[model samples]
Target: MPELLEVEYFRRLAERCAGRTILHIDVPDAHALADGRSPRSLRQAVVGRRIELARRHGKLLVLETDGPALGLRFGMTGGLVVDGELAIDRLLYSPGTFGTAWVRFGIRFDEGELLFHDPRRFGRVSLDPDESRMGPDAMAVTAAELGRALATRGPAPGPALKARLLDQSAIAGIGNLLGDEILWRASLAPSRPARSLAPAELRRLHRHLVATLADLLERGGSHTGDLMAERHLGGRCPKDGSPLERSTVGGRTTWWCPRHQH
Candidate 1:
């Protein structure tokens, strides 16, 4: 899943695409279009307009245009490429699959082109002007705001910390991997209730959340050297040299340093 860092990376790329007039748009995969929006409708909305700016809320990238705004949701395997160069997670992609199954949509300009590539087809291009569907951005929210949101949803919580973290309405932009990473860094078990954390623990979690995001963003949004990286292949904990633990949290495979993360 494309988390906050990944989406922010895309927003930067989309920023370069700003002021470029949309000469054409090719919708090779109709399934990539969000429900209730068609290829023709999307084309008509953006074909002649200029992209004014690009911004992100949560995991959704919004491209503000002279007319309607464009929202991109990169599901599980979605990314953006401009002029044959990968923007976000550039280290993970290769030039071999530019216009293949990975590409769902393409926007052409006079000088270059931008492509939305999603191999799994779970990504989406939406024309919905209403952004009220998403909550506050993860990087933009304060610790106090995060605490209140978690507290409201975690009322009488029991082992739903991971699940609550994945809830966009509660706190946007966190996914399965980020949830586990933050919890591990904070030494908080995902199986523990969110409301169980003390004031100090909440502060620790907030610090870890902000720090982890800053580090990953500095590493181009997908650093393999992260604490919980590659634990799926029986990797050990980076901090304690102990075998990492794996389990299903929020219905997603989660890995953590058992020796260090309580």
Candidate 2:
């Protein structure tokens, strides 16, 4: 799933389309638009309009245009790609391979093209302007703010640490990947209660969240040396080389180091 860092990465890529008029928008698949609007409607709303700005909240990316804003949620496998041959080839040749099908949608500027590629149809695109459903951006939230937000869920028997982080209202942009990584880095258990965390633990968790996300953002939102990188190949703990544990947490598959991630 696209996490906060991945969403932010796409936002930066979308910025390149800003100030340029959308010469055309091709919705090859109607499923790409979660709102059930016709592709023609999408084209009518965006074509010929200038992309004014691009912003992201949690895992959602919103492209503000002179007309209507386009909301993008990269469900499990979605991303924006620039006009690079390697990217285009990936879409054209490897169509439907690796859960990645052809371009769900695309935007052609005067000199370039932007493509939304998703293999699993889990991603969503909508014309609505309602972003009020999302909480504050993960990267922008401070430690104190995070602490307070997590507190709203109450203590044990409320929501587990993984469950709490997965709630966008509690803290935005954290998916299973990030939740496990954050907990692992904090030496915290995924099943631990949100309110059961000690003050020191909260501090450490916040610190890891900021630092780990910073590194991930630098890595172009791609997981490397993390459990996600090796998930398909039986991921092991990067900390102590122990076999990582995999289970469902917050309705998402989670991976954590049993030896290191207490």
Candidate 3:
């Protein structure tokens, strides 16, 4: 499956690729496309009107059109076409990252539809009014609102690390890949009791989250969120190497150097 980056990443990509408005929206498998809306229908929905914004929240990619918003998910195999040209082939994308963007690609009157090619058709495209009211995303939630949401979810930060990282209401832009990376870096056992984390451990985990994300975003936050991986499944750990181990945590592939993670 092609990695599905958080919407914020896509949104940033979309926003940067400003010009030649989105001529058409294509989504083969999406809840919004429920009941079936033809590609023609999608074309009619957004042929003109400046792309007010393009963003990603969680795994959802949103392109806020002057008229309606376009939302997309890259499922297992999906990509974007600018000006009717498929440029995804030129990029050496990482595992945790997916979708299309040239660091910053734009054009004026490019006058071509943004094509989403997904062989499996597991992804979808849709039009909406308010983007904030979406799923598995925290774009709409304010910092304070997110804090309140976290408080309600419980401050015990260790037990359900997976749930916490995947929770859209908690912190945006984190998915399975990032969650595993963060946990591995912090040395907080994946299945450890959330509340059982020592104060120092909790602090360490929080710092890792900030530091890790900050560093990646500096590189444009591609579909692959882990910088250490650099596209390979196995590599020498930055901290230590004893043949990095790979496992399934919360149903997602996870990797860590046993010598350093503990």
Candidate 4:
């Protein structure tokens, strides 16, 4: 899936569209429009508006125009192609090639064009999407913000640690791959209770979370994590050489080093 890091790349690519007035709007796939949105509605909202900025919140990319802001959600295999250049050369789970039929939506500007491509037809386009439902963006979330997100009520434990991390309502941008990679790097067990972390542990997790996201973003995308290759049967831990363990956490496949992540 296109997570925070991937969407950030898309946002940067979209920045090239800024200051350019939209000359035309194309909606080859009506299914790509979000609920309550259509080709005619999108055209009426942004046909002549100029792109002012490109911003990202979690995995959502927003193109602020002189009129309404256009929001994009790259579901599992979606990507952004600007002026025939792809923000990402390839995605982990997506096909290696791009086809004309995969273009779900597009916009033609005075100088160039942008395409929303998704082979799986799971991506979405909307106008002025509701951003308040998401928590603080993971890329810039502070330690204090993370603490509050992980805080549990009463003495009972909250959801599994990995589950809490994956909850966009609590901390946006973390997907299945990032969640496992961050926990593995922080030496935290994926199955730990959300409230089980002590202050020191929480701080460690915060530090690792920020560092891991930065590292992956620079290296490429979420699939470039250190723990990515070891997320399989019979894979050994890179840190301790112990056998890696795989299980389901938060309804997603999880791999962790039992020897070090405690």
Show how many residue pairs clash in every candidate, following the order shown: 0, 2, 20, 0
Ranking by lDDT: 4, 1, 2, 3
Which regions of candidate 1 fall more than 4 Å away from where they truly are? 89-97, 153-155, 223-225
Per-residue error at 20 for model 2, in Å?
0.2
* Per-residue lDDT of model 1, residues 190-261, tens digit only: 877767678888889889888887877886664333654556757887767788878887788878777777
Clashing pairs in 1: none
Candidate 1: residue 61 Cα off by (Å): 0.8
> Model 4 misses residue 159 by how many Å?
0.5
For 79-169, candidate 4 gives per-residue lDDT tens digits of: 9999999898878987767788999999999999999999988889999988998989999999999999998676676699999999998
Give the alpha-carbon lDDT of every model.
0.79, 0.77, 0.53, 0.93
Which 10 consecutive residues of model 3 have the lowest summed lDDT?
101-110
TM-score per candidate, in order? 0.89, 0.84, 0.65, 0.98
Segments of candidate 3 deviating more than 4 angstroms: 1-13, 16-35, 40-44, 84-110, 129-159, 168-170, 198-200, 217-237, 243-245, 257-262
RMSD of each: 2.4, 3.6, 6.1, 1.1
For model 4, the superposed segments whose C-alpha errors exceed 4 Å read: none
